[model samples]
Target: MQDFYIFAKNFHINKAIIRRDGYIYQSLIAFFMTGTGNSYTVARWCAQVAETTGIGSQLVQIKAGEKRGAVPSRSLAVFTYPTHGFTAPWLIMKYIWCLPNGRNLHAIVLPTRAGIRIKGAFFPGLEGTAGYLIAFLLWLRGYHVQGVMGVDMPSNWTALHWGLSKQNAAVIIEMAQSKVKGMLQTVLAGNKHYDGMVQLLVGIALAKVSLMYLIMAQFILAKLFFASDKCNGCSLCQSICPKKALKMVGRQGRPYWTFSCDSCMACMNYCPQKAIEVSPFIITLFYYIATVPVFAYAMSYAAGGDALQWGISLGLGFGIQYGYTLAAIALAYGLLHVALGSRIIRAIAAKLSHTHYFRRYQASNVSLKDIHLHK
Candidate 1:
């Protein structure tokens, strides 16, 4: 009876050791590739949740577009990026492609967007399947996509729309925090959730040829940006550009936009003085009229002196028209700068402040300390 009792106690102790060892082995190491702008906040929140819930240890965070060392196969990877024009930014895609394929890797994709209310229903700020697309791409590269989620962040694109007020933004941030907590719970349970299928399909429909053309147009439109005398030669816009497309040159220390710009609008949105402005509507309209017909004729002539093919014609025509429009606008603005100088340009920009040409609204600056405190 004594021998049997001692064996039983030893067996229970061995079982407990085995269970603890298994738990330690199964704890996942997570890597988060955080996108720029508001995406940093979302990624930080995810890391915090993982640490608090004990779902993952050895968490690593890498900024989108930044270099990273080799990632291990037995790990969890989280990708977080801000949506641009209802799609993931190109910089995020570049990072995804660079990740080495691994059969045992698990992936979670989180896309942050500005929440918009349609009618009485609040649409989670996701415009399309930006999250699912990332998951699908990772799956293609041999990672098991555990989940995809959208987190509603305060909108920062004040160029096309007004930014959320401080009070409203605070409300949205709280709501997002709650949503993220629930998402982490589901993730820890080893379940999958994707809430943007319809948005995904719509995003796919819009992302094909039209998306390419729009990207090309943005490159051209970037040339239309000009700074007023209020610039103060601070070089803030130049420093903040992800693409390094803006250069501060000449004795006046003015910004010069190069062709390398991707039109992410980081410079304009983050400008403290709102000194950058685009050309007026009348000038843009005149440019389009002047260049479109000529490009259309040239494209038709190039196509064997026959009617241009629809796809080829559309692409070439729009590309040339946009390219010339931007060049002309820039040249005209440059000439004006040379003729009247910075003082006159500043006055003109101020006068056109109420016009649709200038981006009048500015996004509120993000406080890093506030984000850390939230954690």
Candidate 2:
């Protein structure tokens, strides 16, 4: 990969022409959609910047469960996607793997993450490396990776954490737009950048652990998802599913997720009626109750003959500790949900839907060179 970068740098310095001519080579911007539409927002911003700056680009929206198609040859390619479990979505990686090699192609990556802010202090919600991973994959496929830019977007994982309110989300969007504009300006200036070593290390560690967790825990916990009487049989969840994991079943037309679910929580978050409910605390309690005793027994047996005693002791200790934590959190959230949280979230969602937040970037495919020349 280092050698590829060196070669790419020399090639660009000696022979490659960076120009505003749209006909010279194609530029492709591909992105994967999730419930919160964060990645979609970043992709649109990138396209707007590229076009406004006289770089022609095209948009490719990748849907879930779709088979890989031929990769289009291009001089520049920008990849954008949301982070899942502190890493790139597995589906996005698969798409990268299927892309045909782009010899001497220049690439940029924009990965959107949901970070938490407490008392004006920001903490990354996930170990973000989706951009880096995509860049590395592109490099392996003979593309000259320009940079990996991480954009912090509003939190969408309401199941595990509180989501941003409408006002807070608006603030975040404005800040992100400003940051993206600066980054794009640097890229258009032919400069190069990379993430810090610490971030890369953290991303690597999280990716490893997250992969295991996804395989072992996600499907089991997904069983907790259920639609209430409020579900109106709209089938919006089924239609929007990228993986085609959801199917409207029964006469009542409730959405049922299959094993193919990536657990992106799009269905749960976007449900209009607030019908689909997934209690993360309850899932946590169930997970510990089901697995803690077995794990404790195994560890105790490996240590000595008092396996039963050790197992019972360890199980009780962990169970009580985790149980108490989850219970308190659940109680607080339940009260908040009943009192105000539900209404607030629904209002925000309604605002977002009415504004067509996901569709705002529909004009991203316009040729920047034409626009510039026309002006």
Index of the highest-TM-score prediction: 1
Q: Tens digit of lDDT per residue, candidate 1, span 1-375?
A: 111111011111111111212321123344443222466556556656656644433444443344443444334566776776677766666666666664556667888877754333455665575787678788877777777877887666554554555566666677887887687556656666677777788888877643753465545555656677777789977866666678886677877777666555667766778776655643465456445565766477456544446667767877787677666656654565453346775666645643224443222344422321122
Clashing pairs in 2: 64-242
Score every model by TM-score. 0.74, 0.69
Model 2 lDDT per residue over 273-364, tens place: 76666644446655654454444444444365476767676766666554554444445434433332244553443343322222111112
lDDT score for residue 343 of model 2: 46
Alpha-carbon deviation at 231 in model 1, angstroms: 1.2
> Global lDDT for candidate 2?
0.59
Task: Looking at model 2, report the run of 10 residues with the lowest lDDT sum.
Answer: 1-10
